[model samples]
Target: MSIPVGDVTGVEFDRNTAFLRHTFLGLFFLLLSLVLTVGIVAAVYLGQVETRTDIAFAGFFGLFAVGGWNVTYGLLSRSNREVIDVYITTEERTHVLCGELADAEFVDACAELVDSDLPTTNRNPKLEAELE
Candidate 1:
């Protein structure tokens, strides 16, 4: 649906939740890998188990390295922010607005604005009939 330009409302920028979640996951993986590598090294040094071949050590080290890289890149390059465009649906079309704001605040504001602008209506009978 298209909205008229005059019907457009405020725009807000919100935090990119996906980016934050992924970043957290990356850090968790990095820490987990480091602990595993350390535990393996400690086990070998303490004679808790028989010394394995170099391949085992290499594999553990590889996992740790990859995790570290992922966390580093995520922190250095990615910002946890995204643009959210808000629009009002008018008789003619929908008008879109975009700007930067806190994610929670933007959502609350958008919900309030949309609720005020639009009326609650019943479901479409044609669509409901198709479902059956």
Candidate 2:
């Protein structure tokens, strides 16, 4: 299937690897909390402790904290910003496109005004004539 081209000038791409942290950390903490809750409840049940309300309340709060952590971690780790790979066009010159024009402009101003001395790599299809 072909990807649809939109009115966007250039598409930025960033992988969703950030979610992996959430998955691993979330599961680990969730399991840990579950085990602890089970142990606590078992102890309370077997010990003939009269503090049934306290044990129940503590277990409920613990589960809520664990569940909340998992949800928040997953959401916060999700990448909202996409990184630009390159500017796609038929233009001859490198456009040096940037998301923040002011930031680029400020850096450009402070940069030494000198022509690039990069040797044209022969592998570049568009610069074949220039390379030759």
* TM-score against native, each model: 0.37, 0.32
Q: What lDDT score belongs to each candidate, Candidate 1 first? A: 0.51, 0.42
TM-score for predicted model 2 compared with the true structure = 0.32
Q: Choose the strongest candidate by lDDT.
A: 1
Error of 2 at 31 (Å): 4.0
User: C-alpha displacement of 77 in model 1, angstroms?
Assistant: 6.8
RMSD each, Å: 10.2, 13.8
Off by over 4 Å in 2: 1-8, 18-23, 52-132
Clash pairs, model 1 backbone: 2-93, 2-94, 3-93, 3-94, 3-95, 13-100, 13-101
Regions of model 1 farther than 4 Å from truth? 5-16, 21-27, 37-57, 72-77, 82-99, 102-116, 119-132
Model 2 clashing residue pairs (backbone): none
